[model samples]
Target: MASSSVAGEPKQSRPGFFKRSVQFFKDAWGELKRVRWPNRKELTSYTMVVMGTCIFIILLIFGFDLGISYVLELIGLR
Candidate 1:
């Protein structure tokens, strides 16, 4: 059956590859221009916060794994 271009239904108009690519980059640049980039001090603080959180989580997971392994060893599983 032929496709129906009904009114009120959204029309799917896919542009050519080159047109789509150029539009994509233009949209990306436009979005980047609207971003609120941090200053150097804020950037450093944010970086440190992220790194500290990652380290804390890693240590937490390691402690749990170590405890589980010890318990398994006590039971002669490994």
Candidate 2:
């Protein structure tokens, strides 16, 4: 069978560490610039929403744990 591989293809080498680092920072900065940054009011509102959700979830978990503990205690397991 004839060989399928080409003989004269140019081999690409890995970039040097310094070049790679510079390229990474350049790409990160470009991406950051493209992001739509939230304004202060929007940031505050989002923060409050996140905190509220977290508190609600914590309270829910606490309620479930308290109920389970009471049940366990009544059954003389604790």
Q: Each model's TM-score?
A: 0.79, 0.86
Residue 28 error for model 2, in Å?
Answer: 0.3
lDDT at position 23, candidate 1: 96
What is candidate 2's lDDT per residue for 1-78, written digit by digit as tens?
565556777656889999999999999999999999999999999999999999999999999999999999999999
Scored by lDDT, the top model is: 1
Off by over 4 Å in 1: 4-13
lDDT of 1 at 62: 100
* Winner by TM-score: 2
CA lDDT for candidate 2: 0.95
Query: Which residues of candidate 2, in runs, are more than 4 Å off?
Result: 1-8
